[model samples]
Target: MKAIVLEKAGGPENLHVAEVTKPCIKENEVLVAVKAISLNPADVKPKYEDEMLSMMYGKERPVILGWDIAGTVTEVGSAVTNFEVGDKVFGMVNFPGIGNAYAEFVAAPEAHLAVMPSNVSFTEAAATTLAALTALQILSGKINKGDKVLIQAGSGGVGHFAIQIAKNFGAYVITTASAKNKDFVLSIGADEAIDYHTQKFEEILSDIDFVLDTQGGKVLENSAKVLKNGGAIITTVAPDLPEGVKAAAEKENKTITNILVHSSAEDMNTLKRMLESGAIKPNIYKTFAFEAMADAHREVEKGRTVGKVIVTI
Candidate 1:
């Protein structure tokens, strides 16, 4: 099997195409013939930082750096009952762990995958896995209908999905993006779009019931100012809330926490239904060939893609 392998952490250039042995499946895992892979900001971190690579894979050499995949199952584990040999599946496999998805085939746990919606393409399904899962997990059971929800960096992968998901739950969705992407965000169910380049979000917005913060530091800090007294802020970027931000949240009786996205077949099924019904559409900014994985990384690192960037296998 052909896979993109990283022997050492350095740069996108270090991600090299090489012939490698195919992975074997565990008793509860299925072998997927990967058709598409989604690239996340998290995927790029380990490629450049040695510590990140060690932290994620624990000193594994020649690591494969990807988790989100959409593909057809070629073989099923002995204990797997939900999926057959030919089922189309999509999910974020072994998130916060090794997925080894940048290859021709991947061995994914059955619990981590959902049947790909018939209406969704492989590329679109791949795009939805990690980013959409994060959005779904963050907002589920957190916001109510008609509540005001703010999603920061609305033009990015997770933000775009969060906007749609929040709106689907009947919340009044507000989001931050540059002026150029204001229309783009609005088209995807955001009730209001704040131009982050020109207007400070906290200065003009207030009484937000929930905030989905994709950008940390000052952005995360400022998000606290707009939340209502009993509202909550969920950040995907920051590991720890800044002291001042935490103090403000505590003083106002608000909630602030960081979220690490995990794999869930149930949530993936929910997303599958949404995708099938067109309640949420993945805005694919671009698609690169499997051989152009490095180019995809470069595009994601630019931090300006309006939505998810995909690599088709």
Candidate 2:
């Protein structure tokens, strides 16, 4: 089998296409002939400083990196019953150890897979898993109708979905982007768009009910000022809540929280239903052939893509 392999974590230049052994299916896993995969921040993060990945997975060499996948089930485990060999599926595999996705095949656990919606294209479905799930979990059990929500990096992959989901929950959504993306963010249901290059979001937004911070650091700290009393701020970019963020939120009588996205079959099903019903749409900024995995990672590192970037096998 041919796969993109990385012997060590460094940069995009270190990725190489090479012949490798095929993965054997486990008792609770299904082997998928991958048709498409999408790039995410998770893919790039491991390539730089992933000591935790090495410690947990004990991966020695020739590591494969990718999670978001859309493919057909070519082989199923003895314990699996919900899906058959011919079923079309889309979902995110677990990170690190199970990440054999940037190749022709991926052996994913049955619990991590979901039936692909007939109306959603393979590319779009492949792109939906991680970003949509992150947005869903962050906004779930929090946002309310008529509430004011602020989403940072609204033109990025997760931000676009967050804007739409918040809108679906009947919130008045405001988003931050450059001037070039103001209209694009608004098109995805943001009620107001703040041009980050020309205007300060803190100066324009106030009394917000929720803040989804995709861009961390100072943007997150500044966001606290605009929250109404008892409002909540959620972020995915980092684990720690900086003292400045906590102080600002405390001053405004608000809460600060950090999030790490976790994959689940149930969340993917909800995303599938939303996609099938035309309530939410995925924005695919680009697609690359499987051989161009390195280039895809490079693009993701730039952090400027308007939406997801996919790799087709």
Candidate 1 segments exceeding 4 Å error: none
| Every model's TM-score | 0.98, 0.95
Q: Candidate 2, residues 1-313: lDDT per residue as tens digits? A: 8888888878898899998887899988899988999888878777775585476345677688778899999999999988899999999898434567788888999988899999988899999988989999899889999999999999999999999999999999999999999899999899999999999989887889999998777888888888889998999866366776677668867988788888788888889889988878999998988888888888888889998999998
Instruction: Give the per-residue lDDT of model 1 (tens digit) for 88-197.
Output: 99999999899999999999999999999999899999999999999999999999999999999999999999999999999999999999999999999999998988
Displacement of residue 66 (Cα, Å) in model 1 is 0.2
User: How much does candidate 1 score in TM-score?
Assistant: 0.98
- For candidate 2, the lDDT comes to 0.87
